[model samples]
Target chain A: MNLMSAISVALLALRVNLLRSVLAMLGIIIGVSAVIAMVSVTEGAKRAMEERIASFGANLLVIRPGSSAFGGRRGGAGTATFLTDADVEAIRSEIPGIVAVSGEMSGSQPMVVAGENWTTNVQGVHSDYFEARDWFVESGRAFTPAEVRSGARVIMIGQTVATELFGAAGPLGQTVRVGAVPMEVIGIMAPKGQSSWGSDQDDTVFAPITTARSRLFGYQFGVRDPVFTIYAEVAPGTNVSHAVADIEELLRVRRNIQPGAEDDFSVNNLAEFIRARNETETQLGVLLAAAAVISLLVGGIGIMNIMLVSVTERTREIGLRLAVGARRADVRNQFLIESVVLCVTGGIAGMAIGVAGAYGIGNLGDFPVSIHPAIAGIAIGAAVFVGLFFGFYPAHRASRLDPIEALRFE
Target chain B: MAAPLIECRDLTRVYRMGGGEVRALDGVSLTIDEGEYVAIMGASGSGKSTFMNLLGALDRPTSGSLKVAGEAIETMGPDQLAAFRNRTIGFVFQQFNLLARTSAEDNAALPLIYSGLKGAERRERARARLQQVGLGERMDHHPSQLSGGQQQRVAIARALVNNPRILLADEPTGALDSQTTVEVLGIFDRLNAEGITVILVTHEQDVADHARRQIVFRDGRIVEDRR
Candidate 1:
């Protein structure tokens, strides 16, 4: 018989045993749905991780002094600190890809404002700090370059510090007492939310580096000039490795480190860190996808099991058809068609359910998901494969049945 | 003279039952001409059913030659034999064997599907045969909705719809009442009268009596062939 007629006959047969057919295809249904949902969910997580990576400063590099990367250390990590503003200037002048650079002097300080006191982290920075951090004034203006040179009493308060210290009344132009010195809040920073490590990023205060050095913290205990770290933002579309090489060479020359002598600083590439995290996440996604495919395989086995039962149950019918005139090929094709129909139909249903389930997961949780159109084709292919794989043996058995015996079967 | 519609020469069938073999139809020979109505009768395991299966091309003989319409049945492959059966033979069963829940018309047209005829022609041919069997009005009725005799009539219609040269019935009326038996036998008689060769397998003397020729089998061989 032609394939079209065989398919129609198969459809008719499945419809006759509608409930049993559905039950038989249930494994394929769950498998396809799981695969689609799992893939979409993994993709969603990857994108979420990418977003967090971007927020974690994808283009920013942190330069820490006195790191263990310098070999022959006398004391600990802070023992070899010799970072200077002149070294920072040489980097700013020498590096081609550096868009912004800031010398940081950070300390946890107890501050009081209008009878309210809060202990908050405070960083001393350059005028370029806002751009380097991708932070902007949500309401007020930032400190000028002149303020850093003059050790200005101006400060920038983060959203958390602003809320905690001032509440409903805004903190702009308010006086905050640090130790015995008072500084005016010049800007309320745009909220930065949480860091990739889950720390509240919007809980710090910012002031001019010179002001931090002379007023509140005196000098960084182990580092020269009270500056402990430097932050650099690479220009967009520029290769960062070359910039790192140039900065390292320039810093080595400025610090008078000879060849074969280990340097006192470490330039940490944030992208490498994010890439490592992303690789781990992608590997996990692959694992999840494999599990989904396994379930689909299990579903195929279910189809095979049910198809065998169907052949056994309809032995007499098979005998009657053979007695009428159906060839063995015709019989085999009919059953194969039936098995394929069951899988393909179930696969389609699973795709619909999976797409809906994926989006539902996205909406119900923090993870975001997207449907890939290729999944439709993949699902159908998988269904056909499963149908053929699990169906062939049963169909062969049905076709091989002796008409005389089958017809005599009760 | 045209060739006999069916001819068998030393036809034998053996079944491998566990260790030893059972000679089901041992060294049997028979012939039936066109336009003849014949009945084969035997007790259970007397090989009458086995002979019918061989005649219907549903089983292969272990030895000797059996021919239908001059085509050797022994040498034909499975697919070729299936096609031969489709084109040359029509079969009826005791239980009607009509697919349940299918309308009488579709049941009658079942054989035509193998003939590769499209729906409209198959339905038309089936419709005419149903009418021929006096079941034209009940064409839409399912097997459950029809009486035993009517169901047998539908089976007759299905058997004749293919316009086969030979009509093989294996206890076609075995499940029916005496009244329905008479009604079904009448249709076979009428079809035989219309120049179609009819072969039936039965143990009932009265059922065998309807045929123009009767053959009796005992111990896997034909013991009697009489008019």
Candidate 2:
């Protein structure tokens, strides 16, 4: 038969047994939609991570004290806290690519202002810490270099803190009292959203490290001239690894560490951090893709099974067609078209459901889900391939039957 | 004279069973001219059905020259045989064999589907044949909705849809009641009288008696021929 008639006949056959045809297509639907939903969600998460890495200054290197052992007990990272002001100053003066360096101390405390009390994160840093972190004041000014020599009781409030402590009145020129100490809000820091680690970046108050050490957390750590963490921003067109090595060498020399002894400090760069996270995400993406492939395979086998049953059930009809002069190729094309039409229809439905499912999951769980236009083409192509691969044997069998024997079949 | 619609010479069909062979049609030769109403009668396994299969070009003979419409059917390939059947032979089966859930027009037009005809032309030819068989009013009725007599008539219309050289009927009335059988046989008589060659293969003597010529087979060979 001609192509048009063959297609029409296949469609008619499928319509004749509508329930069975849909049931046969179910495996393909589930398989395709599951893959699509999983793939889009994975893509969404990867993009989110990349954007988060970009949000923070990409060239910032975080320097902190390494773990220390005392009396056979090893302490956690940053517990040693041997980093001093001399080491920070030497790095600031010594490193060539160090555009900005700031030594910071942070603590969590409740601040009260005019009968309003809110517990939030507080950071103590040099004024240049804003430049290192790519964070700047939206209004007012940062404290100057002279403020470090004589501790100043001044603070800059983050967007969240300003909103919490002063409501719509704004926190600029207001007094935020921490325990018995009162610090004036010199600035409102620009807004920064959630960090990659799922913490709010805008819920902090910034003060000078000299003031924080002499006034608030000095009693807690019991250290003199304590500078635990240092943020160093590398200039554009500078090699970060070389700068990191230079800082490590300068720190070792200033701290009087001999050659071949393990350094007491550790440097963590943002690129390495992102690489580690991406490795884990790539592994997860592969796992999800494998599951999707398997589901498609199972769907293909379902088509094969249903096509076989259909061929057997219609043996007599096949005989009648052959007797009426339908070529063997014509018979084969009819069954092939039926299978392809089944999968293509199922695949389209599956794509719609998958995108909807991805969005539904995204809304419910507060995660990202991105759907690419190319995924639809892939779904349809995969479905046609599956139909052809699985439907061939049954169509061949139908075409090879002996017309006389088939007609006589009960 | 024009070539006979069907010609057979030394026609034989052999089937192999476990360690044995059964000759279904053994060296039987026959000719059927155009515009003849002929019946070949025999009991089950008497080779009447085998002969009909060869005459319709549905089965190849083991050794013979069988021609239909001036083409040597036994020497034809599978595709050629299919085209030969489409253009030259029409078949009516004992069970009617009308596709269920299909309208009478579509069922009758089945042969034209393989003839490379378009939908409009196929429907037109099928319509004419259905009207010829007196089923013009019920053209849209499905097989399930038609009576046994009407169903058989629909099958007859399907047989004539291709305007073939001969109509091959294999126990065409076997599934019908006595009244329906009479009605179906009457349609066949009218078609044959209109200059279309008809071959009826059955064991019922009364059914064979309606034809102008009768040939009886026994043990894969013809035992009697009467005109």
Candidate 3:
């Protein structure tokens, strides 16, 4: 039979039992929608991670003290202060591609401002700390060189700390007591929102590293001017790996680590972490796609099951058509076309539902979700494939039925 | 003389039942000329239905030389037989096997689907046939909406819509009342008078008497042939 007649016949059959056709298509709809929604979510997460990497400075690197073993007791990372001021100075003077470098020490302290007390994170660093972290002062000036030389009790506060301690009033030039030292707030850093690690980024204060070492926390035994971590920025167009190698070599030489001995610090590439996160998202996307495909396969099985039942139910109809001179292929084509129509229709509905679901989820969760055209195409194609794959068996069986027996099937 | 429209030489059909074989048609032979109204009368299991099946090209004889419209039917492939049936024969059944929920016109146009006729032409031909069967006003009515006699008329219209030369009916009026039976037989008589060959299978003598020639079957063999 020609395509038009086959399609018409199939449509007639489906229309005769609309409820059964819809029920058979339900599996395909759910499968396709799930695939689309899952893919969108993964893609959205990947995009968000990329944006985070861009915002956190792609050329940034962090150097932290390595774990130290003493008397057969192993200390965790950053437990030993092997890095010193000389190592930071050597990295600045010796490293060729270094753009900015800052030594950073961080601790939590309760601050009193205008008779309001709030516990907040406090970071001590040089003037270049803002540049290395890609942060800028929103309202007031940054600390001057005199502040670093004199170990001045001046500070920069973040938006959250400002809101908590000062409320609606301007925090610049306000006096806040950090632990036992009274400091003047020099600047309020721009809002940085949340970190990728889910920590509040704008809930901190900053001071010169010299002031923090001498005033806030007393020096430990056998350590002087100690800092926890060092932040470095590579120049634009310079390879971060090359810069990292230079810093490692310079630090090793300055710290006097023996040849063939482990270095006293660990150099970490920030972009590498982002790339790993992307890899994880990609793996999750693949896993979700596989699950969706399995669901589609299940839906295809549902189509096959219903088609087989339809063939059995229409045995007498087949016999009648055969007696009226319909070729066996005609009957097969009719049923196969019917299944494809059902699946394609379901695929369209599924695409709409999936896109709406993704939009809803993205808005509700405050994330980005992108629906790729290729994914939609794949979904529809898979639905069609499922239809053909599952429809063939029942159609073949219907085609091979004996007209005499079928007519007598009652 | 022109060759008969249908001719069978020593036709035989056997069915396998649990390692045993039962002969449904035991070397039966017959010839049906064009434009003849012939009735086949037999009790159940007398092979009358089997004979109708063979004549309609719905099944092949196990061993025989069967020809319809001067073509060897037993040698034809399944597709070729189907095409031959489309072009040369029409069938009416006792159950009036009209497709449910389909309009009478569409049901009548079913055979033309294999003919590859365009939709408008198929419907046009179907409309003409339905009018010929006196169901012109009910062309859009589904089988469920039509009475038994009207449904049978629709089936007859569907059979004739292909413009086949031969009509093979198996107990065509078996489900109708006597009055409706006469009406259906009248249709058969009128179509036969129009120079179309009609072969009907029935056990009722009254139905058989409507035909000009009668053949009776007993034990898968023809016992009497009379005109």
Candidate 4:
């Protein structure tokens, strides 16, 4: 039979029982929609991670004290007090790719401003900390070298602290009590929003390292000018891997570690963190893809079952067609085409549902969802494949039926 | 003299049932010329239906030479036989097997599907055949909307849409009442008068009387042939 008539007859057959046809298609629809929604969600997560990595500064590195082992008990990472101010100075002078270095010390304290009290984290660093972190003062200037050296009672407040301490008022030149010490606000730092870890970056105050050590957090005995973490920036056009290697070598040599012994510090590159996050997203994508595939497989099996039932129910119809000069191939094609049309229809509806579902999830959960056209195309192709792959057996059986026997069947 | 349209020489059809063979058509030989209205009369298990099946090319003879429309059908492959049947013969069943809910024109045009005819041409030919069967005014009506005789007329139109030289009816009026049976028999007589060969299979003597010739079967063999 010609292609047109074959399609028409198939459509007529499907329309004879519209409810059954739709029920048979439901599996495909759900499978395709799940795939689309899952892929879209993962794609959005990947995009969000990339943006966070970009915001965190590609050329930055964080140095922290390594885990310490004492008397068969191991402390967690960043528990040792091995980082000191001298190491920051040595790196600034000795490393080739070093652009800026800062020694950081942080602690939480209650501060009162205009009789409105709020407990916030206070971070202490040198003048170069702003440059290394790509932070800028929106209104006032940063602390000078003299202020950092003399442990001046001056500080910079982040946007969140500024708003809380003095709403709609100038925060500069205001006095805020930090624990028991009163300090003047020197500048208002620009907004940094939230970190990828969902911490509020703006809910902090910045002070000179010397002031924090002497007046707030007491120094560790026998460890001169100790700090918790050190932040650094690499010069542009410098390979970060080589820079990281150089920093690692410098710290290892200065810490007097034996050859083959574990180092007392850890050097972390932002790029490494970005790569790790991307790997995690890839793993998540794979898991979602597996789920989608399983759903599709189930849907394909449903199609096969329905097609078999249809073939058995229409044995007389098959007989009639065969007797009317319809080639066996024609009968097979008609049934196969019917299945494909059903799946294609389901695929289209599933796509619509998936996109809408993705949007709904994004809006409700405050995450992004990106529906890639390539993924959509693949989903539809997979649905069609499912139809053909599952429809073949029933169609083959129908084609091989004996006309005489089939006509004799009730 | 020209060859007969159908020539069967000692045709035999055997059915295998549980390690035994039952001969459905036992050494039956028959000849039918063009433009002859013939009735095949037999009781159940007399092999008249098997003869009709062989004539329609719906089955192969176990051993014998059976030729239809000057072609040896026993040697034709399944596909070739299907094409041959599509082009050379038409069938009307006792059930008046019109597809349900399909328009009369489309039902009549069913056989044309195998001919690879375009939709417009098939529908036009189907319309003309329906007019010939006195169903032109109800061409768009579905089979469910028509009477039993009207549905039979539609089936006849479908059988004739391919313009086959021979029309094969296997108890065409078996499902119809007496009045509708007469109406359908009148259509067969009219087509026969128009020089198209018509074959009818029935046990009713009145049905057989409508044909110009009659053949009776008993024990898989023809017992009588009368004109």
- Which run of 10 residues does model 3 chain A get worst, by summed lDDT? A68-77
Better of 3 and 4 by TM-score: 4
In CAPRI terms, model 3 is classed as medium
lDDT of 2 by residue, A1-410 (tens): 77777777888888888998899888888878877888888888888777776667768888877642222324555445467777778888999989989899888878999999998878889887888888999998888888877889999988999898899996788888975689999999899898877789999999898988888775755455777788898998899999989998888887677899777777778766876777766676687778778888899999999999999999999999999998899888889988998888889888888899889978987768889898899779878988998999999999999889888877
Q: Tell me how far the alpha carbon of residue A403 in candidate 2 is from the true structure, in angstroms, after superposition.
A: 1.1
Candidate 1 per-residue lDDT, tens place, A207-305, comes to: 998899889887447545656778788998988888888888888887778899887778877767767767765776687678777888888888898
What is the per-candidate TM-score for chain B?
Answer: 0.98, 0.98, 0.98, 0.99
- Native interface contacts retained, candidate 3: 0.68
**True-vs-predicted CA distance for residue A10, candidate 2, Å:** 4.4
Error of 4 at A369 (Å): 3.2
**How high is the lDDT of residue A317 in model 1?**
85
DockQ of predictions, in order shown: 0.53, 0.65, 0.59, 0.54
Better of 3 and 4 by lDDT: 4
- The sequence of per-residue lDDT tens digits that candidate 4 reaches over residues A1-410 is 77777778877888898999899989888889888888898899888777776667658888877742222324555455568899999989999988999999999989998779889999999888988888888888799879999999999999999989899999899899998899999999988888878899899999999999888887453588987888999988999889889998999888877899776777888767776867766686788788788988998998899999999988887877788888888889888887787788788888999899888878987767888889769777988899899999999999999887777677
lDDT of each: 0.86, 0.87, 0.87, 0.88
**In terms of lDDT, which candidate is stronger, 2 or 4?**
4
Q: Tell me the docking grade of candidate 4.
A: medium
Query: On a 0 to 100 scale, what is the lDDT of residue A206 in model 2?
Result: 90
In terms of lDDT, the poorest run of 10 residues in model 2 chain A is A67-76
Give the backbone clash total of model 3: 0
Can you write out model 2's per-residue Cα lDDT over B102-216, one digit (the tens) per residue? Answer: 9999999999999989999999999999999999999999999999889989989999999988999999999999988899999889888888999999888899989999999
Displacement of residue B132 (Cα, Å) in model 2 is: 2.3
